[model samples]
Target: MATIAHHPATGAEPAALRLGAGLMALAGVAFIGYAVIFFVRNFTGGFLELGIGPNEVDVGRAQVLAFSPELFRYMSHLHIALSGFIASTGLATAALAWFGVRHGLWWAYVTAIVVPVLALIIALPAHYPYHLATVGHLGLIYVATGIFVAGALVALKPMLQARHT
Candidate 1:
């Protein structure tokens, strides 16, 4: 029987999950970076700048949008929510891929698959109004998400086999 062995989890097999972790980390960093830049340019003088509107809500988000006035609030919610989930997925995926492969944790693999799928599902609402506009965004969301999830699943191979001979 074939068996897989690790370096006693001495942080040696980090490469085991490197592919998945690396993808996740990269995606997460991108999300965080975009959020920072977006948050900055929203109120300040940048591409995300929005015209001051005589609008007030009890609990309103501070994000800016280039959509219709009626859609502004909803779009803000979508952007923030999508950004949050993407960033979260990225970070968790990195951790999952790294530790899961290193320590042979199936939960990490499962998480890798789950996080993106959930994020994509959450973004489904964006397609209702105008699918054309959201096409690119949705594509990006799923591409990045799918890659990591699929990568993690692929990386599970080495961990699933028995090691005892």
Candidate 2:
């Protein structure tokens, strides 16, 4: 006869961990969706959410075209690259949450928290100084950040407990 031993710490996942992972996953999806929007907007010109309409976009495009076609092309490349990076980060975050954080891995929890924080730290300040941080322009990111923060908080205790055990 074979004997099986079960440890409490290795039991079924806690509800808190599940909820936190779900929230983080939701935020990751939001980030991916935003990236898609950004990629489309690169071609469409102007952000409708920011109240920059077609006419404004057209005027801006013409000005940029007149200033330098190469510069305009470079800007397009930058937008596309930024969109790709955002989507990749989102995917990575979601994967970590689902596969790592949900399983109560401290490293996963730390990574899930760090990725977006680094991105925001690098990207957000430019928006504020440029006066581009309008509610319409940044509201979604704000909401997603809030959800991510909530998830990190919710999962923190469980992760700590798991680490000690």
Candidate 3:
């Protein structure tokens, strides 16, 4: 495995870099935790999101259970798949942030940013058209994204400086 190397100009990593990477990692962990919730809800029938209840979700668990077993199974499958993807993304982001960005690797920084941003870009728009963009469904993600952005911004100066020197 590749190891993090300190920049020649900078003998030790800067505090800013560490803080930024830590924030990014925290965001990544949040994603993982959310994924876990999604996964557990699949089995436990806690289909309600944070601020959303069965009524707001447009379909109650009881209704789905009564209407079609197939539909319920399909929904469960979707939840499993979504959870897997989210967890994987979180794992990647955390690894990159803690291992690469913490070490001041520019490529790692870029990739860490790209991975989650790409996911949000692909996933977020669909929510709006369906009016599913409510805070209950997306608030946690928004907070995580904010932390990721803050981390990126915080590390930017130091990363650039390390690169130039």
**Full-model lDDT for every candidate:** 0.52, 0.78, 0.85
18-53, model 1: which lDDT tens digit per residue? 564566555555545545544454334333212212
TM-score of every prediction relative to native = 0.57, 0.83, 0.89
List all candidate RMSDs to the true structure.
Answer: 7.3, 5.0, 3.3
Which pairs clash in model 3? none
Q: After superposition, which runs of candidate 1 have C-alpha atoms over 4 Å from their true positions?
A: 1-4, 8-11, 14-16, 33-41, 44-82, 133-136, 162-165
Using TM-score as the measure, what is the rank order of every candidate, best first? 3, 2, 1
As for TM-score, the candidate ahead, 1 or 2, is 2
User: What does candidate 1 score on TM?
Assistant: 0.57
Model 1, CA-based lDDT: 0.52
Model 1 sits at a Cα RMSD from the real structure of 7.3
User: What is the lDDT for 156 in model 2?
Assistant: 74
lDDT of 3 by residue, 23-132 (tens): 99999999999899888877875754445575457776678878998998888788889999999999999999998898888889999999999999999998887677
